[model samples]
Target chain A: MSTTVDRPLRADARRNREKVLDAARGAFAETGLHAQIEDIARRAGVGVGTVYRHFPTKDALVAALAEAHFAHLADIVEAGARREGDAWEVFAATILDSAAPTAGDAALCEIIAGHPQAIEAAALGQERLKAATGALMGAAQRAGQMRDDATVQDVQAIMCGFGQVAAAQRAGAQMDWQRYLTIALDGLRAR
Target chain B: MSTTVDRPLRADARRNREKVLDAARGAFAETGLHAQIEDIARRAGVGVGTVYRHFPTKDALVAALAEAHFAHLADIVEAGARREGDAWEVFAATILDSAAPTAGDAALCEIIAGHPQAIEAAALGQERLKAATGALMGAAQRAGQMRDDATVQDVQAIMCGFGQVAAAQRAGAQMDWQRYLTIALDGLRAR
Candidate 1:
């Protein structure tokens, strides 16, 4: 076995790994899952071999990136849940934050919608986000911020709709997802 | 020139034409714009040559089908506008009825969204639908049923979103578009 495989990653190696992930994230955010690994390597100032060694495959890299983003979203939603304010504001704000970034990300939105059967790890990440969303929704309903009948499924449908709207906006339809989401959120509010 | 081109369509010829259009409508509604002309002819129990005679190309057939649907939607919106009821109810009902069918028809939704630059006739049909929708929305706003801040653009965005939700629902995700639209419409209502 190569000594490089046996030894722990040194500081420079770790730095290179982080750089590659960062480059991949930026590339994917800009160009979606179709972002080329060679381009990502060039952006990271690393060799294509280095990227392949770390990721092994494109799906692996994509799944890793998707998991991280989903986890980040869950973190954001959970943080919002703990914030001191109207429950609905926390809810709406979190959604707006996600929608704005995701509007340009076709790959991430596909993962969110669970279309074409996402990878197991990415699907797990989505499940985590869904659970976190459910908690926030339940908290809002209990606080009388959201209507009693509102379900996480309804929120999922709305989020998927808003994601497409964001895409439509990107595709030259001039419309505000934030305003439309607010309207839906208002509908979710308890009387 | 072929004699058939100059002669008035006998009853049988007219019936065949209607059959081809009907078959095209059903196939497109079921399988979208990708619905094959041969499949449409087979479904109509007519020969493929018959389909070709009536519709010179798939785009022409698809465009005609989209125009007819748009015209039908425009009529529905206009009829709703004339109906005796609360303006908001009229508006909401019209949206729900349109969404239910459109949710299943992806190609029509794409045309409605003006994606890939829809045919001129399909675009014209959409314009008529928008005018009718505008009339209903204006009536609702004037009657103090909907918010003054709400614009026809908002309605279009919502319709686009709902049409997507309907599509999503068809693709194995169980969702109640009516309930969600109710929430969205509630958000549209004047305070």
Candidate 2:
């Protein structure tokens, strides 16, 4: 009887947490770092106290989002690595897929660019991303499909740069990030 | 006698204006957009009234600085165009030179990334830069030295993206922008 009662309660708590995160992601995507906790709680169909129970603060919410983003990126990299294809094709596709702008991208960019401390909170996810990307980079380099001089760090910087360019475009700058990505991809090709 | 007196006053005002600009540039580079006008006045060895007299507001000061940065980039592009070298070499040199990080680069990146309205104030300077870079890009493309698909706007976006990467590096991210630039340049190549 105790296990049955606790199990439902735990499931309810987990569902509430997921709802809050989903609402917060949408809010942050639209308004960026200035998105309010109250708005996110209302959107989640939860009281503000529930939001505080899960995240404690706006920074905590953002940190959780950042961790999720890193995990998503790691999954992309791992999937690309698993694909049986030309090394260069796999590497380039991974780069393009990871860097392609999405609604959630703006919030990740803001967290990376403005909230360095939040990154610390996402270290486990970041480490997973780093390991996944590093393995892919090594395979591509060993196959002579990508420049040997480029490091995993270089790829991360390029992706981060792409995020900034995309954010700027969304903010009304007239430029295409796909073109920019193409040029960068060419630059990464092995001589 | 009246003309002579007015000439000296004008000269003094111009000198004060230059000093304030120099101080503001240093301050903005070190502290970004959050730098205070009073601190800039103090660094310039002028009264707060002097800075206000010359710039009126922080936005105006930043706009002036942005215009100056654009003009400087225009000068660099024109000088590269005038050089006697392989069109590709000249184009690459110009891009690298312009994108090379400087103390003032951080402030320029902040303005370009954060203040779109200020760009309108620097339209004339931006036009000159566009013309100069366009001519260089045309020459390179015509010589079959650079990728023909790229537009001048593409080049500008890449440079702006590079600026953001450099700024982030300055903020303690361990990344080498020179390597990033090299990869981008390769992407711009005709091959």
Candidate 3:
């Protein structure tokens, strides 16, 4: 029988892992998936070999980074769910905040899109995200804070539109997602 | 001074003009400015010489077609402004309907983008479009059906987003622009 190694990473190893993720996040946000892994390692102040030792492959590194970002977003959604006040307000607040890409999520998307395996992993993450969003939407509807006629699909569309606008803005193009959002929402309000 | 042509075109000339415009609209839509004028004349069941007789240059043809289309859109916008009841509802209806390419506007865009001189003429048409859209939006705000905070810029963004979704639909891709529009508008409503 082969024995499995169960040893923990050393302190230096852990620090290197954190640094690599941070650097990768920044690089992806600035230039997209084409950003080089060696550059990320250099920015992280780690050797290329050290980054490989820690992450195995660029895709693996990106998938791990993406997981962490989604976990952070899930935390925000959970926090909003637990907030006191109308459930609709909580859901709306969370949705609005999440509309813009954080440096991490954008990088994760750029990184993962190149790797088929990472794309599958991201799909799983997206499913988990949908469930979290659905919960918030349901609570709002139940509390009469939001119009019952509105569906989870409606919320997802807003998120997508907002993300597209934010992406354009990141590219130094000005596009407003807010005012149209206001006018559309007025149409959806319960009479 | 040359007398403005006092006589209307004879029956055969009028028939040729209509045939040419229809063919030009379709050819422009399919192939933009690269669509050969000879091909357009063939499609119109006329000679290349006849096409030249009716339209002195590609810009002349494109400008005439664009002028007619923009004038029609302007009429719609004006009608919406004069609507007595809910301005918001009418405004939304008009935008949603017009956002999709009619068989005509797509041809105009294709021709304008295909030819440099036509592009300049198209710019003039766009200026007219913006003026009409601004007037309609102003009316909606004055009636308090739309949020006072909404700007013409925001409306333009919504139109752009809708256009993207419409283009996707045209290519047989499904995207829920309608749902997105609803959620976005709900978010914008004065709550």
Candidate closest to the true structure, highest TM-score: 2
Segments in model 2 whose C-alpha atoms lie over 4 Å from true places: A1-16, A38-50, A101-104, B1-16, B45-50, B101-104
- Give lDDT tens digits, candidate 3, residues B44-105: 99999999998998779878877776566656666666667676677776665554444234
Q: Give the winner by lDDT: 1 or 2.
A: 2
The candidate with the higher TM-score, 1 or 3, is 1
Best by DockQ: 2
| Per-residue lDDT of candidate 3, residues A12-66 (tens digit) | 9989989998898888777666679889989999889988998888878777766
Stretches of candidate 1 above 4 Å error? A1-65, A110-116, A119-121, B1-19, B44-57, B109-116
Candidate 2, TM-score vs. the true structure? 0.87
TM-score of 1: 0.79
| Cα lDDT for residue A108, candidate 2 | 71
Candidate 3 runs further than 4 Å off:
A1-15, A46-60, A100-120, A123-125, A175-188, B1-86, B102-129, B159-175, B186-191
Best by lDDT: 2
Q: Write the per-residue lDDT of candidate 1 for residues A1-191, one digit (tens) a residue.
A: 66565767888888998999999988877776668999999999999999998888988888888778777777777776677777788888877776666666766754554343443576766677778788788878889889898888888778766766765666668788788888877778887
DockQ rank, highest first?
A: 2, 1, 3
How far is B168's C-alpha from truth in model 1 (Å)?
Answer: 1.0
lDDT of 2 at B22: 98
Clashes of each: 0, 1, 9
Pairs that collide in candidate 1 are none
Candidate 3 chain B, poorest ten consecutive residues by summed lDDT: B108-117
